[model samples]
Target chain A: MTAFQPDCAVVITREDFSQDALQAEIFACGGSAGALATFVGLVRGAGPNGVIEAIEVESYPGMTESSIAAIFEEAAQRWSLLAVRVVHRVGRLEAGEQIVYVGVSSLHRREAFAACEFIMDYLKTRAPLWKKELGTGGAWWVEARDTDTEAAERWGL
Target chain B: MKIDVLFFARIREQLGVSRLTAQVEQDITLEQLQLCLAEQHASHWSEVLGGENVVRAVNQVVAENDQVLAEGDEVAFYPPVTGG
Candidate 1:
């Protein structure tokens, strides 16, 4: 008989992440996970500035990690998760670059899918990170979207 | 009491300072601290900090304006989060 040790990691970094590496981590966890779900957000090229050249992400160092960890904690409480990983990039990122990633693994497909979306919803509204879009025309801070708030609220958390 | 104050993103750029130390009275509410800072910096800061949607935190937890402050606490102000 073997023990099942759940794995969870939250990272806020300036460097890029490898989806294959992250997925491999989940696949290697305990060998009990039957499903894996992942989400990757990218820097878009279009905005109010017409054509965004890049985005500068800013975050409160300690709070950023803690807040995302809290979101993962909540997801764990609601779902049967075997593993979870979140990586969000800070500082300057060019268009089409990956900005964030959320991955979850569970005993079943449903749990993995739900936990991934749940973590992302909470992270969008609760994490202490902000984005500023820089374009050829000018630069502006990205505004909080009501749709995001609504999506998070739908979870009733 | 004294506390460290932090600002991020647009608010940091508007204020031209990322972090600062504030001298405050003992047992000041977060709201009171904000008002004190606004009073010291005047109109520009008042306008920036007074925005209805400005988010605040105490000791790294999202906090309401009425949250009490203590010495050595870290307080942060910034726009609502937009990350995924």
Candidate 2:
């Protein structure tokens, strides 16, 4: 394997997101003058129709990165995307904290938007992260949502 | 033989554990381990490993029945993942 791999897709976690880093990444991919779209997933204070106190995210250390990278590769093959980025946080996170980020750049706005949505759709359904909801009553693991599966199936993945 | 068992998602919450180390029987099959776990913790394990809906990954890769076991292998069990 190459020591320094150039990924059309990048995944990371910092104290917070950096606009400079994101912009640099877009330029690094030689994607200037193109439209860039992003989606920032936040930890919500509610679950499926209920109040949530906190949400815990968990993932297999070695497997999560590989899975996310694989999804990025598949999306690149499916869309006319120039660059993409995905970053997710683990451990105890409060509401409004950025849980995940997906960014896509393309020459056309349509492609940028489509690819960003595609990546998020795939990630929501396919990523190996697990979530637990803490609410007034107690804490429980959130069940897999059927709507998410349907959204992913719409993409034929 | 020693094997590392991992739990994720709802199963982890229900069990209140993320991982466990087990000394399973020699030449134990994956199915056997599942059954063993279910037997050990009859109440919760039965629900988590109930039937065919549960997902299993061996060594971080999705696995099926008949997957061979070895010492120091990692086996994980969880409900279907719904992440993005």
Candidate 3:
């Protein structure tokens, strides 16, 4: 067990996030944890039409932070975690740009991996954020997928 | 009672406005507010708010249509979230 970084668990911003910086902050806590897992979500270059241009990400200001906090709180309660971090970008992001980051630290690899995955699944479905894909054809709001809902539900949420 | 109603993403584009205040009877359920907006704005608002899966929130909390609303509460209606 080590010092857990729960205060920085949720970050919703318009600026791009640095994965290395986030990882550094997590490990800087000098925890006895043996494993750290991270996931980064990027905007794809391909779209339903042709090459994608950019995507506009939108979120509810007050609710977005609260939602992320609630999600990370659940993960911390579910596992013996050392640290958890989530950085989600909201604004106009070009294709291939980094969109999100989810990281978890724990004493064992299994909890680290499970908590990382769990945070991502819940973030996708619970966060009050939306995306609109822009491309040659036109811009359209990305619809919620059933697969994401199923992913979150699998955790008994 | 008056409450602030907000629209976001696709719903904001469809409505051509980000937010508006509505006056209604006290203790209106979330669903009633939607119907009232649809009734006031007619087809334009109806088509957008009438969707089966439109997400709603009260005072920044994800809420059901049955949730009771109070004066000065903030209500939001939008499409299902797609953030990663």
- Candidate 3 Cα outliers beyond 4 Å, as residue runs: A1-8
What C-alpha lDDT values do all the predictions have?
0.89, 0.76, 0.88
TM-score of 2: 0.83
Query: Per-residue lDDT tens digits of candidate 3, residues A4-72?
Result: 544346888999988999999889866687999999999998866677799999999989999888877
Query: Model 2: per-residue lDDT, tens digit, A25-131?
Result: 77687744368888888888876658886777777777778777887777767666777777777777787777787877777799778878887887777767777
Clashing pairs in 1: none
Q: What is the alpha-carbon lDDT of model 1 when measured against the actual structure?
A: 0.89
Task: Candidate 1: list runs displaced more than 4 Å.
Answer: A1-5
The C-alpha TM-scores of every prediction are: 0.95, 0.83, 0.94
Q: How do the candidates rank by DockQ, highest first?
A: 3, 1, 2
DockQ category of candidate 3: high
DockQ of each: 0.88, 0.68, 0.88
C-alpha positional error of residue A135 in candidate 1 after TM-score superposition, expressed in Å? 0.9
Could you give me the TM-score of model 3 versus the true structure? Answer: 0.94
Q: Name the top TM-score candidate.
A: 1
lDDT of 1 by residue, B29-48 (tens): 99999999998885899989
**Overall local distance difference test of candidate 3:** 0.88
